[model samples]
Target: MALAMTDASMTDATITLPAIAPRHARDGKLRRMLSRMAILVITMVLVVPVGLVALGSGAGVIALPYEMFELARRAPLLFPAHMIASALVLLLAPAVILTRRRPEFHRPLGRLLGLFVVIGGLTALPVAIISHSTPLARAGFFAQGLVWLYLLGAAYVAIRARDIPRHAHLMTAMVAVTTGAVWFRVITGTAIALRLPFEPVYAASAWLGWMLPLALVLSNPRAFARLLSR
Candidate 1:
C-alpha cells in the first residue's frame, strides 16, 4: 500500500511537469506571434504608401508635363538636400527589410543611415527656415528637421548605451518622418483615385503621417505613464 501510494505521487509529478513546461512554452509562442503580427501590420501600412507613390501618378507618372513643371516650381533651395535625404531614406528601406531576417546586418546599415540622416538634416535645416512655401509646407519641413535631429541624437545615445531597443525606436521614428513625402503623394493619389476632394485630403495625410507614429510612441503605456507622471 505504501509503495503504491509513492508510485502514484511520482507519476502525477512527472505528468504535471511536462504539462507545466508546455503551458509556458505555449505562452511564449503566443507572445512571439503577436509581436510578429504587430510588426507585419505596421510594415504593410508603411509600405503601401511608398509603393503607391512609386507606382501611381505621384512620382511614377514622369512624362506628365504639368506634374514636372509643378515639381520644378516647388524645387526650392533645399531641394537638393531633400532629394538626397529622400533617396537615402528610400535606400534604407530595403536595408531595413533585409535586416528583418539578417539582423546581423542591421547595425552597420543603421549606422550608415544615421550618417545620411545627419547630413540631410544639417543641409536641409537652413533651407526649411528660409523656405517661402505655404504654412503647411514650412511646418512639414520644420517637423522633418526636428525628426532628423532626434534621429541623430538617438543614434548617438544608442551607440553610447549599447541599447538596441532605443536604437530601433529611433530608427522607426526616422523612417516614419522621412517617408512623409511618400505619404503626401499617396494621399493625393488616393484622393484622385477615389474622386474625393484633394487639397484637404493631402493636407490631412501629411500631418497625420508626421504625427501618428510619434503619437504612437508617446502613447505607449510604458512611455505615456512615465511622461504623464513627470
Candidate 2:
C-alpha cells in the first residue's frame, strides 16, 4: 500500500511539471553555432586585411590611399606594432578562453596573452590621437584604449586577490575588448565598400566595435562563469 501511494505521488508530480519542449534544444545549438561563427568571422577579418596591410606596408606597396597613407606615416612603427599585437591577441584569446579546463596551460598562456593586451592598448592610444580623421574618431579610439587597459588591470588585480569569480568577469570583459579591433575593421570595411560617408562610419565603429563584443559576453555570463569554474 505504501509503495502504491509513493508511485502515485511520483506520477502526479511528473504530470504536474511542465513538459520539456524539443525546440529548446535545437534553439540552444543554433545559438551556439551563431556565436562560434561570429568569432570565426572576426578572426578572419583580423587575419586577412591586417595581414595584407602589414605586408603591403612592409613591402612599400602602400595599398592604402594617399590620405590614409599620410596618416599612417605619422607613427609608422607604432601602427605596425599595434596591428601585430592585435593579431597576437586575436590568436591567444581563443586559446585562453577555451583552455579553462587546463590550468596548467592556461596560466602561462594567459600571462602571455595579458602582455599582448597591454601592448595593443598602449599602442592604440597614440595611433588614435595622431591619426585623427576627426575629433570624434580620435576621442572614441582614445576612450577605447583607456577602457581596454582599465579592464585588463582590473582582471590582473582580481586574480592577484584570488577572487576567481571577479577575475573571470574581468577577463571575459578584457577579451571582449580585444575583439574590438576586428569589429572596427569590419564596420569600416563595410562602410567603405558600400561607399557610405567615412567619418560617420569610423565614429560609429569606434563605439560599436568594443560594445558589441562586451554585450555578447555579458549576455552569456552564466556560460562564462561555468567555464571559469572549470
Candidate 3:
C-alpha cells in the first residue's frame, strides 16, 4: 500500500512538471518574437525616410537644372509654397526617424508628417498634371497625392477609434508612399551607372514603389485567403 501511494505521487508530479514546463517555454518563445518584431519596426522607421532623403539630396545635383527651369516657369506665389513643402518633408524625415520610440513625440510628429503630405500633394499634383515630364512621372505624383490623402484620413480614424493595428497599417502605407521619392533616385542612379535605358527604368521605379507594398500586404497568407474566399 505504501509503495503504491509513493508511485502515484511521483506520477502526478511528473505530469504536472511537464505541463508547466511547456507553458513557460511557449511564453518565452512569444516574448522573443515580440522583441524581434519591435527591433525590425524600429529599424524601418529610422532607415527608410532618411535613406531616401540622402539619395534625393544627391539627385538634386543631376536634377538641379530641371528644377530650376520649372521654378522659372512657375508663378512666384507657387514657388515658395513648393519650396516650403519640399523643405518640410526633407526636414521632417529625420525628425520622424529620431522620434519613433517616443509615443508622445511620435504621435504629434506623425500628425505633422500627414499634414506635410497633404500640403505637398496639393502643391505638386496640379503641376504634375500639366508638366511635360513622362507619363509615369505624372501618374506617380497623382497617385502619391491620393495615397497621402488616404493615409491622413486613415490616421485620423485610427486615432479616433484608438486602434493600434489600423494605425500601424496606415503608417506603413504612408512610409511606402514617401519612399517613392527615394526609389526614384535609386532607379535612375542604377540606370545611369549601368548605362541602361534610363526612361523605362525611371518609369518602372515610380510605379514599383507603390506596387511593392501593395503586393506585400495583399500577399499575406491571411489576407490572401480572405480575398480568395470573397
Clashing pairs in 2: none
- 32-106 per-residue lDDT for model 2 (tens digits): 677677757755667446545644553467566675577668878887667667667767777887787789999
Supply the global lDDT for candidate 2. 0.77
Error of 1 at 84 (Å): 3.5
Model-by-model lDDT, in order? 0.62, 0.77, 0.63
**Which 10 consecutive positions of candidate 3 have the poorest summed lDDT?**
221-230
Task: Report lDDT (Cα) of residue 181, candidate 3.
Answer: 60
Question: In model 2, where do residues sit more than 4 Å from their true spots?
Answer: 1-10, 16-34, 37-68, 226-230
Candidate 2 vs candidate 3, TM-score winner = 2
The CA lDDT at 229 in model 2 is 48
lDDT of 3 by residue, 1-230 (tens): 99999999999999999999999978866766674566356446644554544435333433344654565366444434544564466456546645766789987887787777777667667766766668986787677767767776886799789886566566555665665665566677788999999777867876775667555653563442222221
TM-score of each candidate?
0.62, 0.77, 0.63
Order the candidates by lDDT, highest first: 2, 3, 1
lDDT tens readout by residue for model 1, 1-230: 99999999999999999999999978866766675677566556765445443334333343334633455356543445455555565557656645744667976776777776776677566655555545676566677777767876875798689876566566666666666666666677788999997656755765776676666754563542222221
Candidate 1 vs. true structure, TM-score: 0.62
